[model samples]
Target: MASRSFKELSFVSIFFSTLATSYLFFPTVFANTHVISIISPLTLVVLDIQGDGFTAMEYVYSTVLFFATSIILFYVGITNFREERLFSEKPLTSRLADFVSAGVSRDHPHLSLFLLAGFTIPFVFMAQMLTLVLFFNIPMPLSLVLLTVSAAFIEEFAKSIGLYAVARERPGFLTPRNLLLAAVAIGSGFLVGEKLLLFATLAQITESIFGSVLFLSLQVLWMPLLLHITGVLITGGFLLLWGRQGYGPGLIAACTVHSLYNLHFLMGALL
Candidate 1:
């Protein structure tokens, strides 16, 4: 089998990053930026944490924002996925039933169930990152390490769950790529929503619809999408390997890699 070239991965990374950066320059994005700082209504969570809060509140608020963004982005992503037929032909794990969750329409209960759970996995994982940093009083390096490990763990956990459930009941499943597909779908979905909401900060202040749209357009176009995509892709690979090596061994290896990735940032912070 041909290994994926670094060029291929780099291209994937650049493509998403560029798409996001493009929105910044559109003439109207300038106005949208003004609006958000001045006028947009803060979500309840954001509002609640706004003043005289503990330093930890900043982290907590960020965590809540992640959830809010993940919800919208994931929604937009799934909507786009359904329309685009975004499943891969290859399954990370040959055993994972790629068809079960995806076989039915977007409205299917099974699909919805998986979608909900898939999102929660990442949301919880990210929340844990902040929790570890703040409440647990772990050092920044340790928190970062835990964050990466948790991210990988969540991805693998979701895939294995999908694989087992689908392959067990369905025969000759329709697709072999459900787990990765769903995770990416959820991640991209999170990106879309987060882009708009976060960037909307500027546009909301201006109270101009046109500005709002451009802020969104610019926000939706890039890096966050790549981050979400790359992160999911790697996680999928780890999970596939885990399934092959036996669950315990696979989980440890995956988490270690993930931990190290986060440690890069965490250690710097600590130093």
Candidate 2:
């Protein structure tokens, strides 16, 4: 009875949290309503305003709330899965440890590349929200430093997600040859998605100083492509060599390399 009650509570929590999170992404779903009620983490009523827009503080708070609720939803869902035996019998942390250490997987390189390409859209959206929140609330050189580190971590972690997914489903794909192939595919996918996004929605920023730095624009087309490919290779190489224990150190190494690259561009822009 207790377990059933907990499951029901978890389901309700997830459903509402998911609904609130979706609102963050697409508020237009509620555009027809005049009374706007803002809920954070699905339960707390943060604000009730009769306007379409938000104050700067409200916006920041809402973004933070979104992050909180997203985390809650993920945790609740994972716990529910564990309770339902959908996941292995191991504890959640143990399962996660094994998952990361399980190594990489294999698939058709073309298909893998194509599927992974779309991941950049979500990654960019996440990074944009994070960037806006930081730049809005923080000041000066500190903000710049945080932005550089945050951006690098987000992008590198985004690529790692795709690699981890592949590893989870496809065993024996962690060979040196396969790692190189996967790295190439992931990098190519990210390049394609990023360019498409820029061409479609972010064209205006391409000429701005920050835009040039953010996108790593270069006259030589191959430069950005090579950079991304090399970045992923650094992470993938670590995973290939260290098995399950390599992901954290690998991510840190990749982020460090990426951060240096971004910092160089940003400093040049500032100068």
Candidate 3:
């Protein structure tokens, strides 16, 4: 066991060391500054008025926002899971954990179901960066539209991957209600994680606490929060009903709705 652990740690250390070395020397191997700015909406000319690291106030605000939203979403998901599985013989805590972890229950002290759900935040940001860097100059309006459309696919696919892994580990637990609840947990995790990461990323670029705060506030208050939940539910429902048979209709529906939701912002950006 110790030998295996040492090997794993050594591999990780080597991988990161190589990545850092490559990044330092071949920074342009990935996206350039122009492409980065385009992909990151907050780095546009408007909000990036200041140019410093995060202010103390910005840190506090972001922390509060992340935790507050996470707690609400977490509680809601767990509560819903408990209610939905009321007839099941499984204990509420185990059921809740299974739902949050997408049908698998591992015995890890440090890794909670909550943390597993939240993993999508980094996964999504990295995916977005890849797309933006590859297709940099695709026109702003079109880019936004494409982004929204593609994000639906990417996010659904990612969720499917998670579900597949967990289900493979522990089969026969994925029911319709459980799938829906799991989707909610994953989506809630994705939403909060994405928002917090975006805030920090924008803060780093613009150095403007106000801009970061405004962007986050708008997302949490108005359309984005709802849109995120709706998209995930729609996709989850489709996956629950017919995903194993086929996922075409679900993917299209979710993508279309998500794109439509993003239209307002795209138009605003253009005009």
Candidate 4:
């Protein structure tokens, strides 16, 4: 028990140290003359009085911060679960299942969905950062494939985390009617959060073809909302039909559908 405690302590110390190191070194990556602007809607509007938009460094730093925060929160979540003595003689997968099942608030489905919506923002930002980093310099067709697949995987996984957390947390929650309502709630929450973030920090990107593809901005707002709803329903349906073991397959199914949706837009942009 002592050895396990020491190992956990060491791991935490290393994680924080790495985070601090990243913070210290981050400024060195960009020019000293670069003005640091907060990525809020008001800040952007105020700073762009001269018509000069956000700098690349601003976006980079914001993305890095979001990605870092997500990682830290994920670690904290696992630690909290461990502290609750949730881990037992069960296999790793079983422990993970238990963790997911217990992570959400009991009897508070609305609150869980709301929190999940907020939780997804950082993860989606992380996904955008990763997609850009991985496919920045790659050529057209290959980059398109990679970008679509990676984005789909990340976004679907993010949505799935919320779905499973709520669906598996209690009995009768995974029923068809309940899952349908949960899917709608989760999708609506995600859509609102996603659009707000885009309006605040990513409005500029919407002007470009790549941004259009990434954000899936269409003439009608309902399309994106519908897409999100459809994606959640696909996953939720799998869970409803297959029971607890359905999450993995459901996530994969959602990812596949999302990938196809993204690919269609990407192809249209290319042509």
Using lDDT as the measure, the top candidate is 4
TM for candidate 4 is 0.70
Cα lDDT tens digits, model 4, 159-218, are 777777656556577787777777777777777877666666666555645455667634
Backbone clash total for model 4 is 0
Q: For every model shown, what is its TM-score relative to the native structure?
A: 0.38, 0.62, 0.53, 0.70
Candidate 1, which ten residues in sequence have the lowest lDDT sum? 35-44
* Better candidate number, 3 or 4, judged by TM-score: 4
- Total clashing residue pairs per candidate? 22, 1, 1, 0
Question: Tens digits of per-residue lDDT for model 3 on 1-271?
Answer: 1112456558667875664343233313322343233333233322245443434543443243335445655664664454445444554334433454443345531133335546655545445444544444567546655655665567655544455445433555457666666666656665666666666544442233212212322444436656655665666566566644435576678768766655655456446
The alpha-carbon deviation from the true structure for residue 259 of candidate 2, after best TM-score superposition, in angstroms, is 0.6
> Which candidate do you rate higher for lDDT, 1 or 2?
2
RMSD of each: 16.8, 8.7, 10.9, 6.6
CA shift of 49, model 4, Å: 24
- What is the C-alpha local distance difference test score of candidate 3? 0.49
lDDT of 1 by residue, 47-112 (tens): 346542223433343344445646745564554454223444343233123333443354453455
Task: Please provide, for model 2 over 104-168, each residue's C-alpha lDDT reduced to its tens digit, 9 standing for 90 to 100.
Answer: 22336435544554444444544554353335335767766776777777778777766655554
- Candidate 1 structure, TM-score to reference: 0.38
Model 4 clashing residue pairs (backbone): none
Model 4 gets an lDDT of 0.63
